[model samples]
Target: MPALVRAGTAQQWPQALAVPGGVARLSLGPAAERPVVHAGDIPVLVLGDAIEWTAIVGIPLAAPVGEAEVTVQAAPTAPARRVAYRVAAKQYREQRLTVAPRTVDLAPEDLARHERERAHQQHVMATFSTPLPEGLQMRQPVPGRRSSSFGLRRVFNGQARNPHSGMDIAAATGTPVAAPLAGRVIDVGDYFFNGGTVWLDHGGGLLSMYCHLSRMDCQVGDVLRTGDAFCRVGATGRVTGPHLHWGVMLNRTMVDPALFLPA
Candidate 1:
């Protein structure tokens, strides 16, 4: 297959939902070449060819519920233009959970370790590689009940924390976790918060993450086809039970993973 799939229509993979923690698919008009688009400072994924191009931008959950824009440069020498879009507000329900006190209130050494791991993971999320020919639509990485939804305001042990950023699937510890889309393994590590994490680069600033695995079967630089098993669900991270935490990221922003899945 070709490295880049030509997006010949306005309707592309990943349904567009322009709310915070959602996606905005903007048309870049017909260009002789693919236009370069950036949501704020980070580059976004631009698909299509010389005919019609579209910019798929991932809006942060913390984004203001109002106007937003992306910079579009039609060509190398062309002047950049701002394409505006609206980001509607979204209200996510609050979730209260009780976990180990140590996990919530980390020790000094654990805090430092988490900080280092967070930095490395941020770098991994910024990866942008060649576009995938297999396209952007994805399959669920694991088979189970949806135990948690994205963007939930989580209160851990009565202490407020960041909103949940991924979808959690309730599954057995040894149940296999597969690749949602064709991708190259970009990062894998056992961390303080996410333990047994794996990040996959789907190219063009699009990536997917799987966390809390009992086992990781792939390493960095390993390429996997859609549906290929790469890990197993587990309760390796800070959690009350075994599950698969799956996240989809675009342009360095973590978006709702359900946007890439079909109903």
Candidate 2:
């Protein structure tokens, strides 16, 4: 089957109830054939048959829970069409954790190193490649129980920290992790928080990241297909045990990885 034909049959758009810090899959239908869509200013992934297209929208954690809109342009001379979607409210659980004080508070040198790492990651997350992804359905990178820690507002040692941005899968150290979809490896690095991380660009603004790996098998610019082993799970970062931190990025925002799981 052709790539677009296969993608059209495999991908199903989620309903239009956009939850904060979540994802909203909107269908443009036949009218949007060959459309270029954007959620706000950020371009969204559009995939489907010749008659219809679907837009995968990433709702920011801070996005207002209400009506939201996306712009679609079918051609260069065609007028942009605004498609509105509803953003529903979702309440994520709060978690309080007590860890080593130094982990929360870094020294001057550690802080500087962290700052540099953050800048580099920000650039990686902002990558928007041409040729949108064929499909968004993803296979789990490793076989394990998923931790219900995603989107959890965490308070560490009486200090508020950012919400958990990735889905944590508990696995044994050195467990092989596979690629969730076909994509090119865009970034690979070890950082202060995410050790042995690999980021894949699944075309357009769709990206996925695997962090805290015990080993990396692929290098930057490597093309990986679905189910291909690319890394190994481990307790490499600031974590309690061996696990895989899998993140799905859309339009530069880290949305819930569960959204891409097969229904």
The 0-to-1 C-alpha lDDT of every candidate, in the order given, reads: 0.88, 0.81
Whole-model lDDT for model 1 versus the true structure?
0.88
For candidate 2, the per-residue lDDT at 21 reads 71
Global fold similarity of model 1 (TM-score): 0.95
Q: Tell me the number of clashing residue pairs for each predicted model.
A: 0, 0
What ranges in model 2 sit over 4 Å off?
Answer: 1-17, 31-33
Q: What would the per-residue lDDT of candidate 1 be over residues 11-63, giving only the tens digit for each residue? A: 45787888889988887779898888887789999887788887888999999
Q: What is the per-residue lDDT of model 2 for residues 11-122, given as tens digits with 9 covering 90 to 100?
A: 4533233677777766677763578888767888776776866777788887887788889898878999888877778898987877667668888887898999999888
User: Considering only N, C-alpha and C atoms within 3 Å, which residue pairs clash in candidate 2?
Assistant: none
User: Each candidate's TM vs. the true structure?
Assistant: 0.95, 0.89
Poorest stretch of ten by lDDT in candidate 2:
1-10
RMSD after CA superposition, every candidate: 4.5, 4.8
